[model samples]
Target: MQFIDLKAQYERIESEVRARIEAVLQHGQFIMGPEVGELEERLADFVGVRHCVGMSSGTDALLAAMMALEIGRGDEVITTPFTFIATGEMIALLGARPVFVDIDPVTYNMDPAKLEDAITGRARAIMPVSLYGQCADMDAINAVAERHHLPVIEDAAQSFGASYKGRRSCGLSKIGCTSFFPAKPLGAYGDAGACFTDDDALAKALREIRNHGQDRRYHHPRIGLNARLDTMQAAVLLAKLDIFGDEVDARSRLGRRYTELLTARGAGSTELGGDAVLTPFVHPDNVSVFAQYTLQVPDRDSVAEKLSASGVPSAVHYPVPLNDQPVFHVGLPGEETPVGARVAQRVISLPMHPYLTEETQLKVVDAVAAATGLAGS
Candidate 1:
């Protein structure tokens, strides 16, 4: 009944996790430890990238990537407004403007068709989030970026293990960043993140930016932040990486099962009206990690309340579009990006993890059926 069942994952990898951490502890090189480099190499290889720069957190990873790109005041970064605030926050923190673009209703990702219209003279980059563990349409987005001569940054925080058209998430764009927040698909014990790229200069710059701009000991060349990932977290991630491929398969199977079960109960997209539930639509070219297994439900507040009353836990990935948030709000109330604003109000997530049992999953679906007035239909 736990939302993520991290305890179960820990139990499965306890011995390896302990061994890795013990090795780090014995070495006592907490900062810039050997484990960090090992994890980075493994991750880079897994993602099919040339370099992986470990960072303190996903936010810092995004920050460092932007800094490496030289994004700053008066620069405008085009990005979707449907994602986590961190996507926009990083740009704002660097004194850059985050120009909001609406998302596609089906995928809930930035619509590539909208990209051209949003580009302006100051547009410096295009950042697309792989929301809910499925990558955005990278090819189309990259096509647009290429024409505009802009770099594309993939915010792959929820999609670390996902694949798009035979390519991995973090290797799909000019710069890709992912988080190891405890709940993410490939999570660590604590906050951690990494940036991936094939550009040698950008790779070197990212490494330096994460460590006070120091290319070598006490030699600072540019302004930067202390954003290095801790050795302990690197150890945990290394242990998890050993079993991550299997976990990814499990997550995909469970996600499909959830959709099938809901569809059978007359609560699926085919029955999208009244109390029917609208499940996630995965593109044929993409493999999702199902980080949240989210769905769109009408009367979301009441449905959530009923699920809670039935002892079934549910959560919302996001309740408001970024453009509607107080800190980022712009345009009139009705002028907000239409699709994202509407979708945000209806999205809700169920308890999802690789270890989730079918028995437990069935109960969750039954609870949803009851809450949506499709229990016997």
Candidate 2:
């Protein structure tokens, strides 16, 4: 089975997608066309934000937000190390330092208890990534940021449709940045992303930043990058946005089904036990979009190998903590982030998509059970 069933999704939305793309082609305004503005408005409304500035990619969205906040040389942005490199890379790109924090063992999200200790006078912002389509504890993170007088930027790339408390993921922070990387929960056909904010000034700054710091044509107001989202991508996203809510609901149902099946089958070995393969945890106050349906499995490598050999595709969300990566490693072997380090070795993502069939899902669960020696149930 496909790891992510993009083909099925496309088939479901083929007519709408085709119509949107056709409109874009007929308009012949490829760059910053009408569809771009249309998408921005639609996204802003969906996120309940005053503004949504579409950008080139998720990475660019993060960069644009940082630029708008004037986060540069000598500044520090606090974040978890158990996420994609882009989370920290954006900070480093701006000559700022990424202060690594550990994640909660259960949620695999940035641990709020450890967050305060990592903040220093140089801390400009707290960027918390909503990993695997589940939001980090935004309320706790926001409290800490409020106390420190720092802004919070939710790296909501994986959690576009996720909700924290009563608010949406992208609307919970000072600035929320989400990616449309085809693999994300709410994806476009190609590279695209958007930044959301309630603050008008920050919104204005982000718009300028995305267009090479131009207030208008050729009017450079500040140093910026060409991070504008293309009309084609915007068109695709607008089409997808129409059905995103339904897709999120379908994914949630599938995630719940997986959890139920795994629990019923007792898919944990005697040596490992049922607790060893902890399913994805959803907070009582939040709703997960289940972007990856990742699980904590002992002997992750062996499990993945067995699944692959069994014709069941599986992958790791991240094998190594971002702080441990060669590019980010600063010869600091003693730097301790126990939670991140531990989770990095155990987390494995299974095939998950809104269109995943029951038969395919059963096969996936059976593979897991067989791999873990818990297939008897």
Candidate 3:
């Protein structure tokens, strides 16, 4: 089965998608087209935010957010090490230091308890990633940031449709960024992203930053990058947006089903206590979109190989913690993030998408059970 069934999703929205694209083509305003503005309005409303500045990519969105916050050389951004390289890469790109923090053992997200310890005199911002489509503990993270008087940027690339305490993922922080890299929960046809905010000045700054820092035509005011989202991509997103709510619901249902089935076969639990896989744990207050239904298993490589041999595809959201990456590795050997390092070694993601069929899901689960030597419990 496909790891993410994008083709099936395309088929479902084929007509509307084509119509939107056709309209963009007819208008021929490829750069900052009308559809782009329409999408921004739609997205901002969906997230309950006042502004949504469309961007070139999720990485660019993060970079722009930091830029808007004036984070640069000598500044530090605190974030978890158990996520994609883009999080730390953006910090380093701006000549800022990326301070690593450990993740919660259960949620695999930045642990709020570890937040204050990571902050320092140079700490300029807290960038917490919402891993696997579930939001990080934003209320706790925000509280810590408030004490430090620092801004919070939610790297919500995988959690665009998720909710935390009745608030959407991209609307939960001072600056929230999400990706549309064709693989995310709410993906577009090509590279795209957005930054959400309620601050009027920050919103204006973000819009300018995405367009070469031009407040108006040929009026350059600040240093910036060409990070505007393309009109075609915006059109594609607008079409997908129409059905995104249903897709999010389906994904949530599938996630719950995965948990129930894995548990029923006696191969799933909350922790890695035995041979069974340790399933993902969503906080009681959050509604996860389940971008990936990840689990922790012993002998992860062996299990992956077995699953592949059985014609079941699987993937690792991330295998190496950012602190261990050659480019970002600066910590002493003994100072590794205990939980993030350990989880990175064992975490694996199974195929997940809204269109996943129960028959195929059962096959995947059985393959996983056999791989972990827990078949039939």
Candidate 4:
């Protein structure tokens, strides 16, 4: 079984996707094409943001946002250490320091309570990742940013369809970025992403940064990279958007099924806590896109081995905290964020997708029970 069943999704949208691609092919304006503008506008409206600037990839989206914010040498951006390396990589690439913060044990998100203590004169931005498709406490995080005069950049790569307290993930912070990687909730066929914001000037700067800092044709004003999203990717995203909302709902339902089955609460389950696993904690104020439907289990490696043997695929979102990574290991103060470090040793992701069937989930949970010694021998 595939972890993220993109093939299943594609089957449902094949004709529509083909038609969109055909339109782009006829136009032949691959770079800075009309489809890119249309996708950006649609994405902006969906996210309740005033602007959306498309980019070549999720990494470039973050880079463009950092450039627009002028985050560079000697600057520090406070962020969680439990997320994908791209979060810290972008800051390091810009010659800025990523001040690693511990994640909350419950939600596994950046702990807002610890945010203020990490603030220094060099702290320019608060970048909180919406890990595993769930958003962090943006209200509390934003409050700290407001008091300290720092901008909040929501890394919503896994959370495009997620909502926090009636607001969308990308629209919750001062600036937000999301990916169109094939496995994301709302994804394109190829690598793509967009930066979202309400600030007019920041939006303009982001657009320029993604286009070699061009103010007009061939007029380069500042140092930037070629990060424009391709027209084909934009077309795919536009087509995906047609059923994206419905897919989000399906993901949520499927996620609930997994949780129920794993917990021994599904149909015909006689035991409780079937796998002795800890399901993802979604905050009451937020709704996740259920990008991965990950679970924390004891003896993660053994469980994963058994799942693999059973043909039930599983993976880890992060195997090590960012501070512990070799490249970013500067041994600075607050060097090791204990929560993320501890969680990394035990977290394992099960097969998750909007199209995942309940019967398939039952088999996965049964394997989890057997692997974790919860199933009665």
Candidate 5:
């Protein structure tokens, strides 16, 4: 079974995607074409934001947002170490420091209780990643940010369709950035992403930043990068947007099924053995898009090896915490990121997608169970 059934999703929206691409080809305005603005508008409306600035990629979207907020040398951005490197990479790229924080073991997201302690005069923003597919505690994070007068940027790359307290993922912060990586919840044909915000000035700044800091053609207003989203990709996203809601619902149902089936089989006996295995946790106040149906297992390496031997494809969202990564290891003196370290060693992602069939899921579960000697339990 495919880890993420993009093929199935393509089959469902083939005609719409083809037609949208055809229109882009016919128009021949590849750069900053009408489809770009169309997608930006559509995305803005979908995310309940006043503006959406499409960019070259998710990394660029994060960079653009930071640039718009004037995050520069000596500034610090607080975020969890359990997320993708991109979360901290963007801050480091701007010559700013990424203040790594521990995650909440259950949610695998930045722990808000530890947030205030990480902030200092140099803190410019709080970038909380919506890890896996569920959002971090935005209300508490926002409260802390409000007290410190810092902006909050939601890294909603894995959680575009997710909801937190009745608000959409990308609309839950001062600036929300989401990826359109082919593996993301709401993916495009290729590399693409968007930044959302309610503030008009920040929106304008982000637009300029995406286009090499140009207010208009050749009118360089500030240092920026060429981060414009391709018109063709935008067209592709527009087509996918038509059915994204249904896909999200389908994914949620699939997640529920996995939970029910796995729970029924018994967490330890179903797969990876029950010794210290933890199921994915979803908070009652938020809904996950289930970008990855990840779980915690003992001896992750051995479990993955067994799954591989049984022809069941499995992967890890992250094997090492960002704080421990060689590139971004600044070493937070006197701070111990215990939760991030522990989760990094145990988290493993299973095959997850809206189109993943029950039979395929069973095969995967069975393979894991057999490998971990849980088949007879």
Candidate 6:
């Protein structure tokens, strides 16, 4: 079985995707083509934001957000350690420090309770990643940022279609960024991403920053980088938009189905005592896009083995905490983020896609129970 099954999604949109690509080719403006602006406008409307700045990749979207805010050189951005390295990597790249807070054990997101204590004088921004497609407690995070006079950037790479308290993920913060990596919820054919914001001045700044700091052609206003999103990639996204809403609904249903079946089998409940497994936690006030339906399992390595043996695919989102990474480590052990460190060792992501079938989910869950020696329970 395929882990992500991109081919399945592609097959559903092949003709429309080809048509969009053809239109891009006919325009002969591959670099900054009309399709690029069209995609930006459509995306902005979808996210309920004033503007959307398309960029080269999610990493560039993040880097440009920092540049637009002037967050660099001895500044600190508070975040969690249990996410992909890119979130923290961008902060460290700007000669800024990434101060970490512990994550909630259930949500695997930065704990809003511990957030304020990490704010020092140098804290310029609060970057909270919406891990595994569920938004972090953004309302609480934003309140803390408002009190501290700090900007909040949502690393919303995994949560483009997610919602928090009636607001979209990318529209919930000062600046939000999302990816179009082929594996993400709203993916393109190649590398691309976007930054969303309601603030006009910040949006204007981000537009210039992505285009070599140009206010106009040959009029350089500041130092910047080449981070423009490609026209072809934009075209691909435009086609995907036709079915995006339905796909999101399908993903949510699949996520709930996984939880129901696992709960029925007592696989992810405490009834068996030793953490048979743990399901992804969705807050009552929000909706996750289910970018990945992750679960925490004991004896994770053995469970992975059985899944593989049963031809049921699985993967780990992050096996180690970002603070423990060798390149960024300051030779200090990451004892502060105890929950993040503990969960990193146990969390595993099952195959999650809008097209996931009931039979496949059953097979995957049965493999899990068998792997954990709970098949008869």
Candidate 1 ranges with C-alpha deviation above 4 Å: 270-275, 375-377
lDDT values for all models: 0.93, 0.90, 0.93, 0.87, 0.88, 0.90
**Cα lDDT tens digits for candidate 5, 1-377:** 68888889999999999999999899899999999999999999988999999999999999999999999999999998888889999999999999988888788889999999999999999999999999999999999999999999999999999999988999999999999999999898789999999999999999999888999989998988999999999999989999999989988888888877666656632232337556788889998999999988888899999888877888998987888888976566213687777777788899999888889888887776676555343
Q: Write the per-residue lDDT of candidate 4 for residues 1-377, one digit (tens) a residue.
A: 88889999899999999999999899899998999999999999999999999999998999899999999999999999998999999999999999998998867889999999999999999999998889899999999999999999999999999999999989999899999998888888889999999999999999899999998989988878899999999999988899999998888788777776666632222222324567777777888888887777777888899889999999898898889888877565335687787778878888888888878887888887777765441
Indicate the residue-level lDDT of 289 in model 4: 85
In candidate 1, what are the lDDT values of residues 1-377, reduced to their tens digit?
79899999999999999999999999999998999999999999999999999999999999999999999999999999998999999999999999998888888999999889999999999999999999999999999999999999999999999999999999999999999999999999999999999999999999999999999999999988999999999999999999999999999999999999988887565333344579888899999999989999999999999999988889998898888888999987527588888788899999999999999999999998889877452
The regions of model 6 sitting more than 4 angstroms off are 269-274, 330-332, 375-377
For candidate 2, list the clashing residue pairs, or say none: none
Give lDDT tens digits, candidate 3, residues 30-107: 999999999999999999999999999999999999999999999999998999999999999999999999998888
Model 3 lDDT on a 0 to 1 scale:
0.93
Candidate 2 lDDT over 1-377, as tens digits, reads 89998899899899999999999899899999999999999999999999999999999999999999999999999998988999999999999999998888778899999999999999999999999988999999999999999999999999999998878989999999999999988898889999999999999999999998999898998998999999999999988988999998999899989988887776432222224777787888888999899877878889999999999998888988888898888546426687677777888889999998999998999999888776452
Clashes of 5: 1
Q: Which stretches of candidate 4 lie over 4 Å from their true place?
A: 265-276, 330-335, 375-377
Model 5, runs deviating above 4 Å: 268-274, 330-335, 375-377
Q: Which residue runs of candidate 2 sit more than 4 Å off their true CA positions? A: 267-275, 330-335, 375-377
Q: In candidate 4, what residue range of length 10 has the lowest lDDT sum? A: 265-274
RMSD in Å for all candidates:
1.3, 2.1, 1.1, 3.1, 2.4, 1.6
Error of 4 at 373 (Å): 2.1
| Superior candidate under TM-score, 3 versus 5 | 3
- Between candidates 1 and 5, name the one with more favorable TM-score: 1
Clash number for every model? 0, 0, 0, 0, 1, 0
